[model samples]
Target chain A: MRALSGKVAIVGVAESDQIGRVPDKPAIMLHAEAARSALAEAGLTKDDVDGLFTAGISTTELGEYLGIQPKVTDNTSVGGSSFVIHVGHAATAIATGRCQVALVTHGESGRSRVGMPPRVTPPDSLRGQFEAPFGLPQPVGAYALACSRHMYEFGTTKEQLAEIAVATRKWAMLNPKAYLRDPITIEDVLNSRPICWPFNLLDCCLVTDAGGAFVMTSLERARDLRQHPIVVLGFGESHTHAMISQMPSYTSFAARQSGKVAFEMAGVTHDEIDLAMIYDSFTYTVLLSLEELGFCGKGEGGAFVSGQRTAPGGAFPMNTNGGGLSYTHPGMYGVFAVIEAVRQLRHDYLDQGIRQVPDASIALVHGTGGVLSSAGTAILARY
Target chain B: MSGYKKPLPKPDPVTAPFWESLKKHAMKIQRCNDTGKFFFYPRGLSPFTLSDNISWESVSGRGVVHAFTIVYQNRDPAFAEDVPYVVAIVELEEGVRLMSNLVGVEPDPGHVWIGMPVEIVYDDVTEEITLPRFRPVRAT
Candidate 1:
């Protein structure tokens, strides 16, 4: 457990100059812009970054685009959760001297599809053969299935689910950049038009153009950097199934395994989790993840999130960036979550004018990829 | 098929038997004889074991609605006309699960609930493929 704990730290984090719009830049251009900003923030130039990690594109392509010949590169695309796992990878790589500095970047043109290739699956693939035949719309279709089962098993009400959206909207209202900052009510959510039966348009996350990047280096090097280092205490990742049909249990997440490992390594419990930057591709994703991450008992997510507990001034502050529900959400929302966690820990979120959490020393940032099929958890603290 | 532009299952060598059985109006599941567990979406090896010794057997074609959703919109052009269609996962008595659609009932909050018993019905979409759907079982 001590092998990588506190050995590495995230020295800098940044987002593209333009987000929430179909940017003038291409996908690779976004990656470059974010990477350069992160480098500038860390007081390092391209030459200092020896490790490159990315998703939706190869690190080789990114290296060539950024003109950085990384000593180590990882292209671990596990959906939205890829970047958090990259931290664990970066920490281990730096500890082993594989690289001195690691830069992880994520950029997607979800709304504009600018320079992105069409996503196609062969007919015989797991998704094509079973899940696709029914013409299921993702990530809603797959997640709604799990929610329906959770409702059956636990009597989770649509009202309880709407509470999540309501709470998130309250947080969104505090952030000027949130795509939908207008305050929302549970009634409004219920009245919203349904995209998928169990999920209203409000329940689904916003589709926007965005990119985020961060740099990780050994703790020794981080002390000398201009930015305050957010120490990486623990990280864990797990996955059991890809397709919903193959998933062993609807209410469970592979995050249970990953969260346990992360918390144990960090030596922190739920009460000590100062801020939670959970991926909110949809409201259910947050609720289910809260339960899976051990914040609340299984089947108690509805009650746990009620009364806007995660909203401003609530007991727990989650998705302070307003989350994918209101904040700009590219195809992969994980990188943005990590960026927010870092900002909160640095007491730098005031740039958005939102009140900072009093004690942001310890944070739990959990990311889900592929419809809850994969989860990677990171425990970051400001040392 | 009402000019549906949604992707259809193109039965490959491994999954031909599953599609062929659907055409016969029968529900077939791959039973890993060694593990004594049933699996779906026809595969060569058991998910638990590497053993390819399997049997394709017909089940009762009756199961409980494990979960379901009514999709109001979709990405594909084939499903443009399929607004408010029901996508469901049914858990068969054989302990395996299959994803299909719900038929013969209204798709609404009051009508649909999890754990409702359902029986399989076939919708002959094309000459080669028959789409299996489920309807709520009438309390006998």
Candidate 2:
């Protein structure tokens, strides 16, 4: 797995409507707004983007709205990890001169929107008549089952899981864009009303009506751009299916394969990663990714995340911009992870005291989609 | 107000067997004839071999609990009354893990140990359907 190192760089990243219930806006609008914001951030206009990549939003629809005729377009929707996976394709497109600039964006009004299509249930074609009639309905309950298994197998206490929520809140306090900035404790997470067992309300991520986007360009084009170029060092992706039952292993994510591929491509180990922005749709997800990504040995993730090690100014500062848990989780959370990584590398948000890893050179961003069904891993660095 | 009713899941093509078999007080799994592999949530073909050589086979429903959790909260609104229910992943003698409710015991997280022996019991939910649940097997 050769890394796509130094071939492409994320020149700009931006988001739209971080908080509040926004039901009136359609999904495509969020995508367009985020795309415009990223272009503005990069000092480039919509006319400059030649390649358009998006997930969970219609590529042609977004392109039509942006008024750009893209030479290369990808709409690979592998759930939340789709955006991260597109980075690899974007890199390859840029490396071969298929396009000068590629923009990947995602947006959703999951909380406020209505008339959205129900999740796909295989083996039966009827609408809401197949799998939903059975026990597995929403993703929250399905993920809760996995969380319960983690607690049962490794003796992972609720407090240990709550540590993730508590730490993310500390970062969210600094981020004004965050939805839930109120300070919380482990007891608060434990005592919150249980949506599903082992997972109280606070254990889950915030449902946001937001959109995120990032602009990528070839190394040559990035050198001439306005800001310090954060190179796309490596990228990899893997997907299984939407159904929870189909997942090969409940505890270990498919991302382990992609993480290995990405790390191998970057020519770096877990120790070389100065910062990480692993998706935190649920607390168990982060814990599982830690084990799968080789950050710690299997069954040691519970012990690894202890003592606020992932908190601000801790051993490994992760999800520094509050992540999907405390920040915004408008449908797909993959693009937001990339946004945080690029921001941290560029030292753009330092005035807010969010930059903990000073001179941070290497960073990893990972994304999960479906019910832990698909995963994408990427490594970014300041060269 | 409507009278209290246990909201049992409606049987569909995939789960019709598990529900229908409960009417006969039996536990079964869809086993592939060619490869002799077993699967849950019944399907038309074997997942591994993708062969249409699959049929329903009855088992003793005797197995060990691979993993168990005492859920203090219920996700379904109908099961609100049954708070703190025990759910376990039972590994059948045929070597497949299935998710089902554990009954005939107290909901103690510590008491439900992994790899503990367990057996099936069919609880009649409807005239046409019976739900297959599990309970701890008494040590001889």
Candidate 3:
């Protein structure tokens, strides 16, 4: 099988004009605003975009709103990890000469709810028939259920999970755009109101308004773009059950399958990864991703994240942009994960201090979606 | 009664049998005829073999608490009044797992523990709907 490694490069990355709490702008406007800025950063125009990729929203509607007639389009909506998987799909399309310039964008009023469709689980659906009737309180309850099992099987502690929140909050303090900037400690997290058992209010991600986007093209054409091209080195995507009840094992996740393929295709060792952008819809998400991604041994995520190892200035730098826990998590957060990795690789915050991972050459960005159901991992490089 | 605000199971053709079984105070899950592996959330085909050779077999209404959580805040009107309830994943004696609520005990960490034995009890909420819930099993 031929590898898509080095075949595509991301040239531009940007967020909507305003990230947190823009109640006036609807989701589609956010998409247009981000696309405009991303295209300008790449020194390209809307006419130059031939491939449009988005999720959670209609592709045809976004295409008409953006005034772009793309030759190819993808509406692969697999929850939060949709955009990360789109990155891999775009690379494949470009490598096969299906399209030249691909635009991946995201916009959601997760908090404001303006122009957002009503969230529904129909009575006839599988979830409606089986899981929804139990009043699990979605996403959180599902995550909490898995966390309970993690604690049972591995003896993981709530204090250890608090360490992840503390570390990510530290990074959030450095980013001006992060939603929750105040510094918090383990005790503060532990003391926070309990939303669901095993998950305190502080452990949950903020629901805010935001939009993010990035532009990519063939590697040969990327060198001439406005910004340094960040190559799509290796990528992998996988999904397990949609319902938390049907999950094969609550303690393990599909990231193991996705991460292995990503690492193998990238041909890089664990130590070579300079930064990791694991989606943090919840603190346990990070700990589980760390273990499943081979950063640490299974049943050791609690110990691995102890003492703020993943915090800034620690042994490993992760979620430098605060992550969904502290930063803006507008429903789907995969695009923001890629946006942060691109910014770090380009040294966007080098002079600003603290948030940038010094000389960041390779980054592993992973996104978990749908109650820890789907995972998409991408290995990006700045060679 | 019109006052039961909680969400109820909406069964269709593929899943009507499971709900009908619950109305009779019994539990039946889809089992693959070939592999003898049982599956929950009844479906037409076997998840293991993807064959139409499936049967709705009666299963013991007994299981163990695989995992659980006590929800304190739920904004949905149907569930807001029922805060601090026990929502759990029960692994049945037949080896299939399903999400349900645990009753007959306080919704507290001290009262609930993983691997605790549980048995099913039917709640005939509406004329047409009967919800299946679990409770701690007493030692024989």
Best lDDT among the predictions, by candidate number: 3
TM-score of chain A of each: 0.98, 0.95, 0.99
TM-score of chain B of 3: 0.96
lDDT of each: 0.88, 0.79, 0.92
* Per-residue lDDT of candidate 1, residues A311-383 (tens digit): 8888999988889999878888999999989988988865554457776899999999997889999999997
Docking quality of model 1: it rates as medium
What would the per-residue lDDT of candidate 1 be over residues B1-140, giving only the tens digit for each residue?
A: 35545677888888889888989998687999998988887888887697998989998899998888888888677787878888888999998888889988887756888888999999887776788889999998
A1-383 per-residue lDDT for model 3 (tens digits): 13689889999999999999999999888888899999999999989999999998988998999898898899989889999999899999998899999999999998999889998889779988788788989899999999999999999999999999999999999999999999999999999999999999999999999999999999999988889899998989999989999999988888999899988888899999999999999999999999999999999999999989989999999999999999899889999999999999988888877778989999999999999999999999995
lDDT by residue for model 2 over A1-383, one digit each (tens)? Answer: 46357789999898875444667787777787888888888888888999999977578978888898999999999888889998888998998889999999888877887424564444333213223333432566567667767776778888888889888888888888888899999899999986656678888888888888999998778888887889988988987656664455677878888899899888888998989998898898899888888999888888888888888888989998888899889777999999889988888766766455677889999999888989899999985
Off by over 4 Å in 1: A350-354, B1-4
Better of 1 and 3 by TM-score: 3
Provide the DockQ value for model 3.
0.84
Q: Please tell me how candidate 2 rates in CAPRI terms.
A: acceptable
| 10 residues in a row with least lDDT, candidate 3 chain B | B1-10
Q: Give the poorly placed runs of model 2, Cα more than 4 Å off.
A: A1-3, A118-137, A354-356, B1-23, B53-55, B68-88, B105-113, B123-129, B138-140
lDDT of 2: 0.79
